[model samples]
Target: MTQASESHNGLPTEIPSCALLQLLANSLVLSQTAPYLSCYDVLNLAATARPFRFLVYHTPNVFRRLELGNVKTAQFDIDAIDRGGETWRNVQLDENLTEDDFYSGPLRGIFSNLRRMDILRDVQVLSLDGLSVTAELVHDILVDPAYSVRILSIRGVKNLNERKLRGALQYACRSSRPRGTPRLKGLYVFGPRDTVPALAAAHEGSGSSSPTSPATVATAWNNRSQKALSDALAEEPEAWYVRRGSQFPHRISSEWASTLVACSGIVSFDSVLCTGPRHFNSPAWGTVNTEALDAAASSTAPSVPHFSVATHSLGGCASCGAAPEGWTVWGEEVVASRRESDGRRTSESCMTDLARFPLLAPPPMHSASLRVAMCPAGQTVRSRLPFIPTVKQQKARFIPRCFDCIRDRYCGGCHRWWCESCYIGPRASSPGGYAASSTGPDSVSSPFPNTSAASDDNAGLVSKIRDGVCADGKCSLGQR
Candidate 1:
């Protein structure tokens, strides 16, 4: 046989390098393998050659899921670990990076690193779980005009306050305007119940003049007994209180109630409360009662066909109930219920106890139970009926007539009905030519005819009634 041109190791040595590259590029291994690489593995591959860099950084849909901070192994990236380590420390200390610069500073390197990758623009689902998430980080992400993030999950994040939460929500709910629509659709936030107070504080400090601010409704409680309200606040600071004059009597906190009402484009918001050992044991366990408050308010607000809020506490360990010395039943009924049972316990039995003693039990330790669904194009505040009580007949009689004048008209002041003349002052075209007098406290009431000292107390009472009505002949009850 003619001496065969020896092929190197039975390979085609004569094949051109360009053809070999084309063959490799066309092979399923190269074309389809990038999607299978772990984020860290992809980073390593990108560092090896230009082709991989192009594949990972420039390829569309290659990085649809971008997770930062601590997540399950499936989402964790080694490159993120390195980025958060000493490399990030050096970047923070760099003199060239200004504090105001959006790209530099403590707690900002992760975002900067993400920005550099360019692949994040395509990220559809972003999870910032188990990270030291700053308000600035959240603000930057949601406020970015070009951001394409759709679903965001924030669990075990630190320093996340209500201002940041509200800012993010507002940004997510912001209309795209000329751009057509927003990309963010859903947000999930879960954490210890202790954070609830921080959220309240943030809302209080925001100084927003919107109708939903707690300050606007603070006056609605002016007529209530201060001592009683103070006692309730002392017992449970996060407890919800119904406005003394609201149409629906269900109680809820002004701040959170406004938050729920102000929310637009929200399809559903659900919160669950679970009693944990931390509530009893932790020093910071005061404001863990938002679930009950939210649930109560949900019933009073305008009913949305899609909106719903539900809250329930989880039962403590039944085995713990058996432990004689260290164990403490949540309430008297819990202790009795445990004793009444047939001495058999299952998860179902514990859950049954949870339902049976919902409000009787103390607040929960963990409150990782806030879930919100948003529409892609954003939403408008649902049109709500004015929060005025509807007419009701009972025992062949109507109640809530004006204490002064017995007429059946909506009472915006005390949430009762009053005749139009008594509640809204004398009509403009009165037959007696009596102009509508000012209802201010200083105004002398002509209704009380007695001038003697014995009638002085009665005069004071009449004066208080006049002060209760609006000076403009309109109901002075603040916005719900």
Candidate 2:
């Protein structure tokens, strides 16, 4: 649309709207608006005008985040490519490939599509999650001066070798670039088999009172890696990797542990793996002996051995007295030997929820001496107890669970379990010390010295909790 106005010579002068749009496009207004626009929205807007198209292609903010690995987008591309007689699987070609070779590969169309959309240049956050991208492609992207990419996510990139990925990251970190140019400050590499043993060990040793935080775990693991970033954590603390799987898999290799530790800068990594009740249904819960599980559940003495050497130094469970932090309630004792004549007791128990816990060394079918029932919660009103009773309380007696079973909403002082709702409710009961508030306002004073406001302060509360106390302010357990 054009607007006409009278000129000094009485001739009509035409005014162009594109000139106004162009000015605004190059201004701070466009920068502000670009972040809120999706990749599609920006492309659509650019298509509407030549000036917009040029500005959108050149502007860094317009494509700061390029999510090439989005599930829906990937699916759409796959369908579209299939219709065009193209394959979707990655190319398994000879090593030391080039960009020209990539153009003829399975990922050829994707790169072409990226070029068509002008995506890669100046992209700060690029997510190539679940793509079978080669290490060369990833390294090229990281090293490219055109890209301002600060974070690169390569989760589920199966073909990416650890050594090649390491070299690429090391090169990018040490590469001499212009001032104010961003280096790879954040990297996420989550493959199916990747696991960290240091974190698992730390988690096993950590307890209700002295929990191993993610930051602490990262720092400890980073120390082991021996490669420190100049200002990695200070700039981007959230730089990390996440496995969409179990906290502790049954079989973990030493190589995988070393790889996790060896990951260097911009790779400033942390792991937040999945945990909780639903994890029981996973394939990790395969072996179980019904009769042994039943027997162990009803056994008078349910003693479990400590597996980790580190956990031994941390002492045992407060309730069970001898069971260590990561103690196993399934599988035979470490001392037992197995024979083929002793067939696995393939019972209905293996298919049940009770078989959720990770198996110890011995095959569950071979021994009935080690299996124990899973902890189940009970109703609060009927129980009328400070500590929440297990479901077994309705039929039989209460059984003390391993630290892993009763993780959250549990008292570290006495290892007593509490319902999730009650722990976070308005009472705001502290996990430390004997929770007098849960019993009622008329409850007796805490076992520690003073019950005054000053004594209930942060320092006093910590001391009282550390010293140890349970429901009735009478737990006789000593400090760790």
Candidate 3:
């Protein structure tokens, strides 16, 4: 029923009980504001009232990208808070505590709200990174005929692999997508393979425990948290656990040719080259770096060159332009005569060959060293070395052909890599003497000084270095 109120002018005004919601849900107002709100913000707003819940849930724009990474953290916080710090610490310290012993505990409130909302209706991009999502939830999202998600990121999702993704991929390939709309491009399964060195150093400096010490406890937490909310809805099938095989299950090996045959919908496989965090700018994951992938996803393109950022090792020779297999750098005396007895290349042999090449990989800001010259392309280079110490000290993160870059020269002083042109060009001979020596000048006379590793701006630091200006605005090369 409408109620009448007296205005300041003594006029009778009709005000409805739902007047507030009516004004807020006006098309003009919603259109102006809805785009800016995040998934959490929308969910939080919806919880305020019943009408708001219906409005937020019905809006397709609100669910374009679903980032539920924080949900996992929320679950952890509730569990830790519910159990006192002493109890939680005891659980962490328990040596005999198996992963099976841990459970998600009571965290069905926010998660229950999440499941009730129809956030998946028009979702184009879905990120479940680090979430303990159930196989049922994953299957329903992927295999369902109603929901259509273009790009699904499942990095760090426990117990998920090719076996679980098979039905989704099959459905994506066979299903018909509307014109101009995105088709299921790829399912990302890559994440940070190892902890950042800076983080490890920070922990050590802070007198924190070893990173590996909490791994068992973390595993147990992840297992118990898997579908803690979904379990309330329905029990998962036993086959879901059986198919995973091991506690640490292997995803579809992108290295295998059979993987492509199995998952036909996936335009590109980047599980091997994912060396950094998945959310931010990583050249390894084409969706974050390249628009060419989006175009490829819509059209029928058998091969996507832009998708292969880590295709070649160091490219061809700078002079004759010979291929990597036959071409060898001039001063590469390390593996000059190295030969494979079986005439077949393995990962081990590839890493051996990579040792001879002068290369540099971009480091994530969190892990960047003050000693090294930074590259704008920010991501950790994944390198596993048991043999070569020279390259190890350089903090080379990736193996040969792991990342795509063409640098013919490496400087140990500035800890930077350069191409022949950049090494010999006028810019190299500029004020900073950036190219003065392959091994930069002595610290006392060197123009290119190391910047602080604490600086968050990589682009600014790299720009300043390339311009050949010292931090003090003086030219070390004795020229302006």
Candidate 4:
């Protein structure tokens, strides 16, 4: 066996030649074995020996998918909260290091080390789900010239707003050299809704026609918040900002759609959801701003191909367009009833003429309280100073029903319309009892138990007259 094949510790001391090892590694490709090796698996193989390490490090084609954080099948050692921040700085900078070696390190370190190792340069699919990503990190990875990243998924990352997202995309598209090269093809960003306005502001600032100033952007955001608040107040006086539930994790705002339209080279955008305070009749997702997208597509150079934007929620309820079955807007009332012997006002005695309705109530002479009425238009109309309204303008106020539950009680606290089932309590016996009843022409059953009463009033307007029973079996709207 000679010195070359000499045995040491009951093992041959001679190692396989680099060429032979390379050939063996090459043979481990998809045609012979599995199509791909995980980032972890590749790193493990690399740790075996110097020859194997060299083969794994140089052979970038072997790794097509790189999942960083905890996925369905795999759980990374990196902390979800710390996001490998503390661990990354201490990681040893050795030549044999792979991304899996930095599993305990930050995403930034992994990306940087990948660039240093030249491993992920050919990586096709990169999933950063269940990870904490910064704007700068996102920009660096997406715009890195060394990376030919085709599919990028950043779902479940907190605080990643539309502006940062759009910036990364724009940077990626711009960084693609000589044009016509495949930039990022697929992007999945299911981030929080609060990040949307910043993206919208950025897009507005970069507008070709009229650029919005920072002050304008601030004003616009404030206005949007104020509008939301006003709408909430109209539903109920004690309303505040409350998150609405949806099938998807992230809330898709109008600004999000605009951001998607503005960005280029994104083939498929997934996991978009509609922002709530969503009506029962609201579509799972809002319509994509196709007009803006079309306009964007038209403005872009013909060389840039338009990719399809996808969302989980898109269509809305058909009943959403129609007004509630019975709604009226009437003025305030001034009740004057004498106590009865039975301690209950008789039906005949309680009945009052419609003309006697307080079109203009007598203002309290001494009281300092200012009564502010929320108009149907979601604006506050003060009644301190009395003003005569024309007969034509004296219309009955219509209260819209909860689109989902068809219940009349709208929660001002959450700014969401809820039926007795949602706002009050859970149903006792049957789930079907809580569901919204279909009002099809041929359907025999009516949502309201007193259908005859509803029909008697002017065009179903009397439906509002019926008392609303809450989940607790108490009449929330009071007895008729």
| True lDDT of residue 75, candidate 1 | 31
- The better candidate by TM-score, 1 or 2, is 2
What CA RMSD would you report for each candidate?
24.8, 25.5, 22.5, 28.2
Q: Give each model a TM-score.
A: 0.34, 0.36, 0.35, 0.37
lDDT of 4 by residue, 206-244 (tens): 455443688867776776677666655554211111122
lDDT (C-alpha) at residue 196 in model 2: 19
Score each candidate by Cα lDDT.
0.35, 0.39, 0.36, 0.39
Task: Return the candidate ranking by TM-score, descending.
Answer: 4, 2, 3, 1
lDDT of 2 by residue, 27-142 (tens): 46666676555566777887985556656675556666665554344432222212333333554434444543443244445555766656755566665666656777767666
Residue 148 lDDT, candidate 2, scale 0-100: 60
Top lDDT: which candidate number?
4
lDDT of 4 at 246: 26
Candidate 2 clash pair list: 185-266, 292-368
User: What is candidate 3's lDDT per residue for 269-319, written digit by digit as tens?
Assistant: 332221121212222332222221122121222332222223222322222
TM-score, cand. 2? 0.36
